[model samples]
Target chain A: MGIHIGVDLGGTNVRAAVVLENGTVERLLQEKTEPEQGAEFTIQKIIHMVENLAEGRTIEGIGIGAPGPLDPHRGVILNPPNLPGWDEVAIVDQIKAHFSVDVQLTNDANVAALAEARYGNGRGFSSVFYITVSTGVGGGLVLDGKVFNGAQGYAGEIGNMILNPNGYHYSNLNKGSLESYASGTAIGKRAYELYGIKGGSEEVFDRLKNGDEQAQRVVDDAIEYLAMGIANLTHILNPEVFVIGGGVMNAGDLVWVPLKERIKKYLYPELVPMMNLKPSALSGDAGVIGASLLTRK
Target chain B: MGIHIGVDLGGTNVRAAVVLENGTVERLLQEKTEPEQGAEFTIQKIIHMVENLAEGRTIEGIGIGAPGPLDPHRGVILNPPNLPGWDEVAIVDQIKAHFSVDVQLTNDANVAALAEARYGNGRGFSSVFYITVSTGVGGGLVLDGKVFNGAQGYAGEIGNMILNPNGYHYSNLNKGSLESYASGTAIGKRAYELYGIKGGSEEVFDRLKNGDEQAQRVVDDAIEYLAMGIANLTHILNPEVFVIGGGVMNAGDLVWVPLKERIKKYLYPELVPMMNLKPSALSGDAGVIGASLLTRK
Candidate 1:
């Protein structure tokens, strides 16, 4: 079987892994992205990492997952919001110029979805909708073992879905977007507003576990909106399984038990049995693992 | 270059058409369904219509679009709410036994989507999401010229999507479902409640054209909610084009102009140009025409 290299590129860090055809990570390494130094510096760092990982082993292809709004077809990283000085960089061309092998690029969420569907909890599922509820809520759909990219490669932008037209107004998005209520950023903001405490989503979950009434209210609202968003996707896609990942899911039963109950209330009686929600099995490595599978295309 | 037959079965009427491979209707006929006569009688009537449509001409396959909750895989019409006598009726097997030809069965909305994707405004588009906003709001997705039937064949049940949790509650569906606010039946009920006038959606439009303020309010509300529903789908699926049909669309500019303007408010700035909403071209014959295309699978 051929060997492959997978790269998970983010604003804060860069990671690369050598993976086998059977979706196993053979060797992995991580380093700071240091985006302040610019795209050329970052690109060289990535190439160096891949070269070291490849060593004497023959690598057939390389796949990279980047924060998106990038053109996957053209292989250019457009102006992604998180990574500074990485606008319209020909990452694919630059990497391919040195590697002498295929290089594929896709959105981070999309690669994670592919990884989960192929190697994690969704391995047996033909259709999977993967949702990440961290800093911002994002999602990707894997249908029939392939990423279902809609027109313009902008499908699965589920976080932008409206949950309440009259709710909070985010400057970047419309009022009451799903992300405004369910994302980790939203939870932290709500907790700060209600109790005048500046803390992360983990802090809010801790307060809830300690039976803080205000914290409980904040978490309950997030669960309700998240469940509503999931139910809406169920109506449209009816995927075999919904694989949820992200830092917020670390709340575990505090989110899952109530979320499943809320989802049932919104779904059709007949569709209740079809609504299968599972926690993502790959955790932090999903990005690199999924990036590797991009070469399969 | 082969001929196929398409059947559109409804509670009140049955329509069949001979369709060419290029998606043209060669010959068409319609008659009362009289479903009260029972499932066996309806099946026999359908067989008779197909025989007449064939008329000694060689046909490669047949496709039937039925009111759903039906099993497309097993080809069974399972206890649809509208068809009282259709309880697990093996329509496909019975028809195939008589004609010895390939027969495909799918939900009415899905078949309509298929027809529109093949022959209507979606002809040049790669992905199309078709929506019908008449007595009820229903939708179907056609991706790469094929109907995307998700897990258990219940995909595209967009009517069941909730727009407002505290709004109207239907006995069969969750509160504030899109159908509760946008369907023709909902429009009529709202019209009666507001003005004490029991009238159809056409009457409401007529009143709006004549400058009745109450009628205008009802329609404007419907248009707003419909746009919200479309915008929700836009954020999730991001299809190339959205083709809308059904009796409500007959209001034309009253719905189209506001729907387009309102949808823009909810979409991402970059995605605004990609949102293409078109009126359905096949009109009343979409069901039958789309059914015929199902055999293309």
Candidate 2:
């Protein structure tokens, strides 16, 4: 049986892995995208990492999961915020030129949702919403076991949905979006605003863990907003379960416990009993796993 | 050829009709859903209307679209706010027993999305988010020509996604859901609070059409919030188009023109050019048409 290749192309790194049919990582390779060197160079870097991972083995197909606002149907990265100087690059054709294989591409969040649907927290559900709480919040939606690609192939971009209306500004996706409050940057900003200090997100989280008063306030505020965002998802999509992944989840119980409580507090009373709030089962490897399954069909 | 029977069960009335494959309605029948009669009796009323609409024709399947929180998988209606006493009614079973046809049930909003996808504004799009800015905002999501029933069969309920953080004292869905700021109820409440009067939601839209200062402020505030909400959707789903419906949209260009402009202002700089925002194509018959299509399969 031929193995599939999953490539996760991020601004700082290009991670490639050979995935078996059962969703296991068989072989892995990593390198830098070096996007500052221009689109062609980044494309070449992606090819190099994939080639290195393949090592002359027979390959089924390839899937690349990248940052958002890109055209998933066309496999073009349209000026993602994290990867600068790469705008409207025909990534699919460029990759095809380097390797003779079928290829699929999607925003990273959508890929993550796919991973959850097939192998992680969302496996048993027909509709799933996956959220990654890392440097910034990102999300993807899976409806009936297939990625719910919107008219523009951007259906599950949940982070930008506004969460707060009284903030510095308004984002159409969500006001006071999950990003505005749950993302690391937002947490840091809130920490600084609350404590008048720099490099405090980690410190405040640590303090909250250790029972520090001021830190608890900042962390509590973030959790409140995060829970509110989750509750928004609960009210809007009513997904079976919300899979929360990404680096911030390292805060563990600090995040999940309060987030679940607040979401329950705010969800429609009828829906509150049916809602499921859970952490992402696949964490670090979600991107690779989701990307690998990208070529399943 | 066998046709499908659809029943649009609403708080005020029940409309039943037989729909042909090409999206035509025949033998349409309408009657009030008298709540004083209780839940079991209401189900009987619906069954009677559907049988009357079916007349002598052989119907293959039956579909019912009701005020939601319906367990699409279980075919139960879980006490939606609009229709009281509809607590976990096994609507699909009741209809099936009465007509001896396959029966399906979903929220009115979800079926509306299906209707838009199959026979209305949502045609030609792989995914569509159908939202009604009416008495209480409700929504539906259709992906790849199918309604997206979440894990628990509740998805595309965007109306309750909170917009305000501190302005409204609401329940679990969102303290300041879109309904709090932009729904017909919210519009009237805000107008009443601002202008100190009372009347139909249409009256406020009429006053705005006539350029009443206070009414415009109230309406404008609502519109701005709505635009902000759309922006949030753009950020999250990046949908190709938003097919808006409901009583509020009857304001026509007076509402959509400015609303679209404001939404663009909030989109990511690169994505603003790719978005398409439009008024809903189906009107009074949306619920019925959507309900009809729900039984198509």
Candidate 3:
């Protein structure tokens, strides 16, 4: 088999890596995506990055992980807010035209899920639900090493999962959604509304580390909703393992210890003992690595 | 090919049937379970039923659907409230001693899910999530025509899914759990508490048919929570279809019409147009039919 090329195309940057058959990434490239320049420009830049990374080698297949609101089955990008001007851009078709290799596309969270299931914290588990709690909450499910994208490619859209019908209303998301209360943005907003603190989650965490009481309350409240969200997922899907990542999780022990303790309250008593929650091990590389692994399926 | 036997073991009675390879039931037998007589008596009773149903023909396999917390992997029953005095019954092994055919065990909900996936409203869908809003809410997931039991066999435990932390407290379920707010029992209890209507869901529905305002409010609130639960499941799983059953749905248009309308408010706009929620078709026979299907894998 020839080299598998993984592409992580984000609004800010596009990355490509030549991955070995065993899921190792060697040669890599990174360039500005400049999505404002339009889908054609970004698509051409991605092709340039992939070509440069492959270095004349016979390319086996290419996989790209981008923002959602796209059709994976038809390889069409349906105007995701993050990718301005990409109104139904056929990314896969464009890439396929330039190179005689199979091209596939999926949301970023799904790509990360596949990577974690194959070679990260989710390794060895038969089923894994990967969650990202960064700017907005997102998720993906990998069953038996295959990404289980739901009927409309919107399966892992957990950020919009309503937790409190009367809770906060964030943009178009449902009121009291997990993302509205537990995401980094949510934490920062709550902190500002409560204390007029100008900084975001980073500033709030710093204050918590300094033993600030208000910050402690805010952190505790965020973890509480996050815990509820996880408990809901556990009851609904019961995946073998949950591999979580994102800016909120980066708070490390502050979020982890409380998260593990709080989820137990929502789970059935029997499930509390054997719950398998692990921090994602691949870190930021999951996007590119997961993209490459998608070609294997 | 040999014949397959399915056993549905409930608190009040036991049902056995000879199911054709195409998921059709040609003959069935029903008898009192009398589980209070203890595990040995019930095991022997099941053996006699199987033997009678098989009529000395070559038995290909046997499958049993019973109340849960049963261990499907080990074929053990772990003291379900429905099967009292059954602290730990090695059901599969006990049945296997009298017959040489393969034996399998799974929860009643899971068996029903398999039945609906193969022969009812969920047929032809690659993934189906089945929900029963009876005295207590429960659920099961069938993916690619196979029961997608979660890691510890708690997958589809939607009864305990938390929707409102400050909502309601029903039995041992989480406060504001889906079951606490939306199950048939919940509807009856709410009716009794608010308007002294004492006949449970059946009475409430009867009153609502007369256009009782209190009854309408009770029904509407229950449907609201149920809609939230469905929306949550949709955002997380996005299965191809949802097959719903149980006594509450028997209210027909009174429940179905508002439920279809309420769930739309919580879902993403695009998803509203394609939500495929259907009433379960097989009814009471699903248990035996689905149990027989367990052996096909």
Candidate 4:
């Protein structure tokens, strides 16, 4: 067995880890991304982190999980809003040049999907759809342990999935998009707009946890739209299971209980009993862990 | 080197065909399903059809394309409204008892998808999403020439996909479902309700063909909902190609021209350029041809 290195490059932080075959971390390191300095600076930072984590171990392969709008097939990081000023960065090529083994790249959502399907809650299922309702509602479909990135690498871009044609306008996403209704950012904005609660999603969840009727109403509305998105996905893909993660999901029972109940209303009667959904086990570590496992393929 | 028989057991008729390796029908026969007579009677008729088509040749395998709610894995035809009183009939077991080879079964939408992906317009695409806009809107996902029947064999049940929470209801499907808005049956019903156009979808198309403004508006509303469904599918699966077929598509340019133009507005900028959608090449023959091809696996 050879050493596998995983790099998760986010806007604020870049994490690197030397992961074991069974998803165990031998060593891990983190550094400020400072992406505004440019793609080259971030690439150097990633390389330094990897070198330190490896400590001269003969590396088998390296995998990276980055923000979307990037090309997984080409291994290029396009100008995603998260990675500002980093236009057309050939991340894989740069990393591959430094490493002796192969380099692979995929979006953050896909990385989590792979992690969940292989090493976490979605482990036993043949098909696993991983949905992260964080700042935005992104999803990844993992089939037989590989990410189904679709024709243009846009397969799991479910954030822009239109739920209501005239619902809400969030950034450049479609009006009434799922992200606009269910995402953490959306929840925070919704809380402020509806009840003038400036505290955001955390505050809303806290209020709901404390048994506030107003918070329940707001959450019910969000859950309703979220259920529609999941149901649309279910009717379309019928994957074995759905593993939901991200900051929004951390609301715990406030979201999970209502979500589980809401989703049932949309599924076929026969499917109701077999609707397999679970929370992500890997949590924040999924990005790096899934990246490391990508080398196995 | 072997002979394959395909049986398309519909509510109205049962068509059996001896299909070549290249999806060509060597010989075909048809008879009234007489499902009302009972599943047992229909089974005898199917066996008779297959026996006649085989003509004492060494039979290889048999495949069936039927309406859904059937268990594809167990080869059981559940109580679908189309096949009245055929509840949990072990069609495969019964057919296998009469034949010396394996018997395959799947929903009609899946069979069409398999046919389109392997022998028709979707040929050459790695993943094909085939949508049949007939009396009802149903779809199938074919990945790498194989049908992805999903967990409970409900994959590609796009007809039930919820487009609007408060939209139209067709049978027991989700309110505001794609089928309720875009299917031929839906079009006819909507046309009749809005303009008292008793001539059904044909009249709507004919009127729209002659530049009827009212027909144009009705078609536009339906197209808008249909566009949402397609856009949702595009973002969710991002398959290589989409092959659309069925009675509604036969309306030709009336639906196709508007559908193509409308769908663009809902897709991502990158996907807009690479949207590989086409008319189903096999058309009405997809069910029979796809059923036959199923035996190959």
The global C-alpha lDDT for each of the candidates, from Candidate 1 onward, is 0.87, 0.78, 0.91, 0.89
Report the lDDT of model 2 for residue B93. 88
Candidate 4 lDDT for residue B237: 87
Q: Estimate, for each residue in B131-197, the C-alpha lDDT of model 2 and write its tens digit.
A: 8888877888787777877666666777777777776643334667788788888888877777874
Candidate 4 lDDT by residue in tens digits, A1-297:
668988898999999998888888788898899999999999998988988887877889999999988888899998888998989999999988887579999999999999999999999999999999888899999999999989878899999888778688898787788998988888889888888988888888889889988788888888889999999898888899999999888888878988999899898988899989899999578888999988886
What lDDT tens digits, residue by residue, belong to model 3 across residues B1-297?
Answer: 889999999999999999998888989999999999998998898898888888879999999999988778889999888888898799999888879789999999999999999999999999999999998999999999899878878888899888889888998889999999899999999999999999998889999999999999999999999999999999898989999999999999999999999999999887899899999998799999999999987
Better of 1 and 3 by DockQ: 3
lDDT of 4 by residue, B235-260 (tens): 88889999999888887888888898
Candidate 1 residue-wise lDDT, A214-262, digit = tens = 8888989989989989988988988889999998898889888999998
Give the Å error, residue B52, model 4: 0.8
TM-score of 2: 0.94
lDDT tens readout by residue for model 1, B1-297:
457999999989999999877778889989988888998898899899988998887778999999878878799998887788678999999999998989999999999999899999888888899999988888999988988888877788888887777777654766788888888888888898888767777788889889899888888888888988898888788899999998888888988898899888888777788789999998678888899988876
Q: Give one digit per residue, the lDDT tens place, for model 3 in A102-217.
A: 99999999999999999999999999999999988999999999998888888899999888888999968899999999988898999999999879998999998898999899
lDDT of 2 by residue, A81-122 (tens): 688877898998889877878888998888888998988888
Model 4, backbone clash pairs (residues 3+ apart or across chains), number: 0
Say which candidate scores most in DockQ. 3
Model 3 misplaced stretches (Cα beyond 4 Å): none
The DockQ assigned to candidate 2 is 0.62
TM-score of chain B of each: 0.96, 0.95, 0.98, 0.98
lDDT of 1: 0.87
Q: How many clashes in each structure?
A: 0, 23, 0, 0
